[model samples]
Target: MKVLYVLLCCVVLCLNVLASSDEEDDKQLVEMERSADLENRKRLHTTNTFIKKHVKQRTVRGKITHFVCQNAVTMEKLTFMFALPEQNFNEDPVIQHAMELELQREMHEGLDLTEVEVADLAYHEKNMNDLGSDRRVMLKPDLALLILDIILNPTNYEHFDFIHTCRMIGLFWSVKDPTSFITNAEVTPDDNTCVIHHGTTVVKSFQYDDDSIVYVDNVTHKVLNPSFVLDLA
Candidate 1:
């Protein structure tokens, strides 16, 4: 019994010593990696030849609207616009990416987000990325991630609304395109009475340095009368 007790005590002390040694080793490794990353960033920033100087940039803007359907019972319309920054046509791809990231950070600051939940839709059930599976992929070949959002209580119209039910679904891929996705949406009220409101929402985004512009336009019309309510979804 005495021998066994001494052996157990030695084993515990050895384990504690090994654990402390491992902790020290991990700390040293992290510090080394952080130092390396900082040095690389400094080198990139100080390199004067990284980005070209004194180049011409072009800014293009346009707007278009179309009526998909117009009838007494239902009406749907679409409109879109874009305002691209003045970027040198032959700018270095890396520098262009840095500029876009800076712009995105500036735009997202102080932005408000609506609460959303994951929606259960039939199309989302199958494994779309499985090459051997029978399910068909719904996105483009270069798309690495996709998200779908659905308003839960879309019919419940309110003035100066504070909250709304929504759903967001995300899909990820092993490989993705190098482009960033940006979108904006707004809802406006017309007048009060037999409330007839016509609002248009525009979604705009910039593609990668090599890709073209992308946008989405949506126009919605709703009439809330004494005995009838027309909602848009």
Candidate 2:
């Protein structure tokens, strides 16, 4: 009877030790998760602060020119815009450097462009440069700034409604080669009308009035689309 009692006591002690160890593990797991969450929040706060400062320093200073083009062969429409500032905004060099670094990090970690598309962009850029095209070359920093401006202050842009749905941003270069699908092009001024021609033959034409560019709300201070901003963030 004495031996049996001792064995029972030993079993109970072993079970208590196991329960204590499990409790410790659970505590450690919770701490790890809490630490990770805190770190993430800190990172987000830093990014938001930087963006706010950058936006304040650089408001859309001048006219926004909207461009829409269509590929003749594929009929795929490409739309983009350029915000031409009258004079260079005097921004702090430190802020500019920080913004560039942050944008570079994001591009390195979260690039969504496919390899083929990237190759095509490079090829077109090289071809245009070789042919002495005078069009503005879209740089990485320019694209990042453009996106920030659009998301923050959509009212400054002409076609905010159309721009919100754009899959790609930045300048689109046309290849001058015979095999290029983007051979024919059209330009619409403030009148909002376009006529595309193929060697003196009118192939396609379209028009978009002021009604087409509608603003959902007039909140200039807040981000127009949180989801879109988060995707880029």
Candidate 3:
């Protein structure tokens, strides 16, 4: 009987130790998770600060009304429009000269163009003479990088307002079905509407109003209304 009691006590003591160890493990896990989350937040804050500082230094003016990007591997194309608020073009020679210098620096660092090719392209496409002309300017890849940078990393609506204000209207078509895609689309900036048509049939439509932007899915026949607020700073 005394031996039986001793065995029972030992078993109880073992269970108590196990329970305490499990509780301690759970507590350590929770603390590790909390520390990880805090570190992630700190890293995010640092990254955002760095991006904002750089964005402020680069002066990107003018509204990119339309942009087209193509995937190199798939040959898929993305054509989009933005209803950006108009601003007077900056004609300050100092700012223009500074922009030219920056463009030269970026070309040297980012592009694989020779010095001669760079000068020729910059003169023809990005010179102040062509920029000030009344005709529409065709931007080459080198100059387009500046606009793409602003579009990708926007600090405010004034920086690039499309993500917040406009609807993303995309059409996916391959070389097989090229004729079925939209050949011509009209962008009405007054009402903020872009309607893509295929042989008189409305393929995709996006409309924006005061409170929200509405997208009509032709495939599902469903309506999506996403709310947006214009941040004009």
TM-score of 3: 0.33
Pick by lDDT: which candidate is best? 3
Candidate 1 versus the native: TM-score? 0.25
Worst 10 residues of 3 by lDDT: 80-89
Which is the winner by TM-score between candidate 1 and candidate 3? 3
The TM-score values for the models, in the order shown, are 0.25, 0.34, 0.33
Total clashing residue pairs per candidate? 0, 0, 0
Backbone clashes counted, model 2 = 0
* Residue lDDT tens for model 3, 22-102: 999999999997764444333223222322333344421222122322122111122111110011114343433333333
Best-to-worst TM-score order: 2, 3, 1
**lDDT of the candidates, in the order given:** 0.24, 0.34, 0.36
lDDT of 1 by residue, 24-87 (tens): 9999999997764443333222211111110011110000001111111111111010112222
